[model samples]
Target: MISGDVDAELRRLADDPSFPHRDAARHAIRFRAEGDVSDLVAIEDDPHPCAMTDVVFAMAGSKRTWLNWVPMPAEAICNVANEVGSRRAEGEDLGLVSLALSAAEPASAITASERVMGRVELGIGDFPAPDIRMPLRRGRYAIWRYDGTDPVPAVPAPSGAAIRVLHEVGGEPWSSPLSGYVQAEPLGALPLADLLGLLAHLPGPPDTPRWEYLAKSTPTYWYRLLQPWVCLGILRHAADEPWATSTRREVLLDLALGIEDWTADAALFALVTAAYRESELRAEVHQVVRARLNAAASAPRLVTIEESLAHLMLITPGCTADDRALATAVLARAAEAGEEDEDEQAPPPSKAEKRRWWQRRG
Candidate 1:
């Protein structure tokens, strides 16, 4: 523990140019200090793991950001992807039973429970049968079902692209809100835009919410995409539809909650009709995300994402830089608003002024 009062320590740290202690202090019982006073009030019940993962999520059902973080050491962000793998292996988390089933050859696993119609029959990624409430118990081991109803929580996928990115540019330990949030650097390999595009192509139970996982899963493809702003943007686009239930809407909610990057992969899926890039989208969105990621531990979700995006130097990744550059451009535009140009501010055109102008023109 650092010496001195919390406020005093905060003051000392605030003087530094860069954001530090940002990652190490997330979700702790003891109160911590922050550069922005707003940051302190934003995370009122922070530090406790159970305070609510989605507190960071804009919506009530939004997914967790930490789980699918491309950058290592997500502070205060719940790393559910890592947990799911561990839990599934131990038979602790029932949610992930589907991954194993999907990996297995056909006829390897059997189910006895009644599955909902149009549930697993159609097609898509192998998913869990959340509808199947109970376990398949028998002789030696209990047989779990994979009806493909539920979605898997993505941590960070370690594909060649990701490894290449990390290996090249590399990452620096992040600035987080959690204490002892650990330190690591980015292997600064610029991310490719088209990772997990398959999410778009997957056919699912039409009647049931096609994009239900957007609201169901704790850490979904949304926040993992690292573009909550994109969700808000798309939500604005579909606000008029009212009853429109496209996968796009579901995808937007995930984006808002930080499950998936809306711009890079999500938007591309809709525009180009691709799914193979969905995971790649998850992987690539990080570029824009890191651009906006503030001290994950300190600022409110809004502020953190904004600040992080604001400080980014270069964003060469999957999606266009419109939203990425939007922050500063907006601010610049706002600043220029009040100042009137001398030419425009000239006295109202009177008879004399008009005559002078006319004479000059002649």
Candidate 2:
């Protein structure tokens, strides 16, 4: 939409080798004039390039420097604590003592970091789940015994002392290339319109081998956005947004089937896990699985795709007969290609694994 002398001046700035902000100028010009010249941009120059970056930049304000994100809902605190407890019980060197403090009926805590904030609550009749842990942060935590009902940040209190310095909880750092988003702002601060804008403008499937190879090196911010806990939390918070109604499901289905990387599995995982509570999403997942299975007949099945199929069989609820048949045929194709079936290799768990089912990127 940019035209007139302004467009000419911007283009000149972008093309001027001596202009210190030439790259920014180029991005501005590219942003205003649509149609992807992304193909022409060097990977080094656009390491985490995606429409989401544009959305995040505009929404977060141009004056910021770092992105502060809360990766999970408050409920995930209990999950993380329970897993740490489990690991300690098994004599593993998780290096943390277990705490069992009784709070009057409902226990509440406030989870806050840099820009994001949420509250964790354990209701009177309900206790935390056994082995469904989701990690939130990665650092040393101070655990204190407080009797009052005032909300606090913490892990479960151990039996020994009233206050203790708890070493960092065993969790992976949620670092992404988009960690530095040109400024400091809480992810919770982003508006639903901006979030949906990013979702709607996501790049479609790669059509070129160069893009495919590049995908292996530079991932979109969706890698962080679509993490299981983050995606689930967003769905909960934006229950009224198009995410709850239709936009999320549609975008996820497209990414699950179109994208060909861990991000795709993340998309697929979000679809299946969200389906656990939403019947409409469950139906959508079934349709996606059916279509994906049909396409597997000829498409080159990568490990990511195989693992996605395994997740479908393992976690997807109300699996239909037709869907199962398609999956079986797809696994057969994978076998012919000499790829190991992930499901066959998985050991039955004594308790549900409290981590992402799919392999993590090293």
Candidate 3:
């Protein structure tokens, strides 16, 4: 049974005419009933093409069912390829293309793979099929090939050609946002003190709506700035220090709460790392994060928030019970709203049909 808080949230979501959270809420409800989010895969059949790309990335990251991601539907793959093609043609960055190529089995997306390969071949003068070599249990490693072949023994690392392709298309322009700041120093480096100073000076909690702050600044600037710290263990290092000041913690927490859309991953990384070092801060961080997620659950673009949550669960597998519960509750609200919408739109079934549906399950 759904908890009272979750049920009330669902009711509020359902009654809202804007219906921003419809899809996510519905998926949540189904997840609660089925006990597995993957059970809602059928929802992908008619998803927005761009949203489907995000779904593909999310499913790939989910180690529990990564193998099943190979044979995605052809139409969906085509849509993603077309998006890549259009973006490439317009001279836009091909970061998404690189991700698609990395995650998809070339055989499963034969035609789309060919198109991407054609671009790489033309750009780099080679047909190197990039492979992601992942280490497995017991001193084993699995090499995933674009051609969908069985895993092979890890041998020589990926070729320079493949690495070049990844370099050219793998990341966004601001992948390292701190470069400019660090480079400005005479030594072309930023000390930890300076880095902390820069972070503290970033936009703080505002009296205006959070979205207004987001709109005024580049959406990903803060996340990009914080990512390096998260990756280099700087955030963790700071949290572990007994002398760490409240100023540092407050700056980090404010940034964490300010996160929305794609920046959620960075926030999760920072917050989770901080919480891991300071156990006392865990509950407070969870509360703040849950509130942020609840507010975003009703936004028009949920893919960013969804992907953020998925990445958080993926990285901190052992600490996700609370997050999972919160996710289920939010999704359940979406699901209930979906049912109401469907009920309003769908024609009433005959008594015989309803009886037959129930009888079939028995």
Candidate 4:
């Protein structure tokens, strides 16, 4: 049997008016100890989106810290779409995990997303598997989603095939010197500017399935190819150049502002790189990046800003002293904000004491 204190806490949470799906939370807690998630499927029948989300999180034993949760039911999947739509409408940053999980549910999730987000701009990893039948609407575009994961398959590409595809896509051929460098050092060690140069010719949006296939099959080349365009947009803005006039620049900016659109590592890299290149932009970059980090930290589930900063340091060891200091300050502020939020959400000490009594009895 579950501990009486846990049961009472679950009941209290279920009854909490702030969360719409009270009964779902209660019942979900009741059955959470069960090994199989199938029993929780009935919660999907509930019309309240929050209730379904609660049940899904409960079944998966996932704390609702971040906006995203896993083991989401197919029926509850639409809730994620609805949330994404609403957040995008309000001009808020959606969490990275939320977008990835939503993409995993391609059908209704995609439909709801397109209806709300309009002409969805997807990353390479964001593409639904080739088998997925996307709607016939015209506005969706495919760009690279750089998560820092080496998507390159173990098998080497057929001779000349990679170069042929690069030429076909209008991208510059990989340089022999850079190729030798990549072979010698870690792929992450490649210069950001060179990566941007390679991405210059790659066309944006309206990409074909063939292009997607080629990119996915040869992820390292695809990453090197696509990053230039994404990185250049940030660099342009950092240099105080006029970027608002360009539609491509607008898309790239939108992707940056919409935190869920790109991987956390990719987003951080762009911001940090921009800051590193243009000392003048460090303050602005710090503010923007801090806001997103704080937003993630403030979510119901705790996403440590420190972890993100640590990952950034590991991937981009060349970050300047100023960059490191700014990141450190941003993380400290985010941590403080998270603590304040937790204090606000926590029940009174008297209530906690009573709950402790129940725990002692159990």
Q: Compose the digit string of candidate 2's lDDT tens values, residues 1-362.
A: 11246556766866889855556566646634541223112211345546543332232212111112322221223334434434543556643222222211111211111001112232222223311011111122112123343333233322211111101110112222233221112322334333332232222222345334423332222223333323332243334566544555554554455523233444555565455434556666766655554543343212224524543443344565555565666556545533432443565521212221211111
Q: TM-score of model 2 relative to the true fold?
A: 0.31
List the candidates' TM-scores in order. Answer: 0.22, 0.31, 0.32, 0.28
TM-score of 3: 0.32
lDDT (Cα atoms) of all candidates against the true structure = 0.26, 0.35, 0.35, 0.36
lDDT of 3 by residue, 165-207 (tens): 2222212222111221122222112233433332222221222
Mind giving the per-residue lDDT tens digits that candidate 4 earns over 43-136? 4334665534543433323331111111121222234344554565455875423232322322322333333334333322333232122211
Instruction: List the candidate numbers ranked by TM-score, top first.
Output: 3, 2, 4, 1
> Which pairs clash inside model 4?
65-300, 65-301, 66-301, 196-228
Question: Residue-wise lDDT of candidate 1 within 1-362, one digit each (tens)?
Answer: 22235444344444545633322233111222212212322333234423232222111111112211322212111223334323443445434222212211111101100011111221222222311212111122111223353333222333554333332321221122121011112211122211222122111112223223322332222233322222222323333443235444444323322321222222322221111112334333444343323222122221212322332211212333554455455334323532432335566653222221211010
Q: What is the lDDT of residue 175 in candidate 2?
A: 25
Q: Which of 1 and 4 is the better model by TM-score?
A: 4
Displacement of residue 80 (Cα, Å) in model 3 is 9.2
lDDT of 3: 0.35
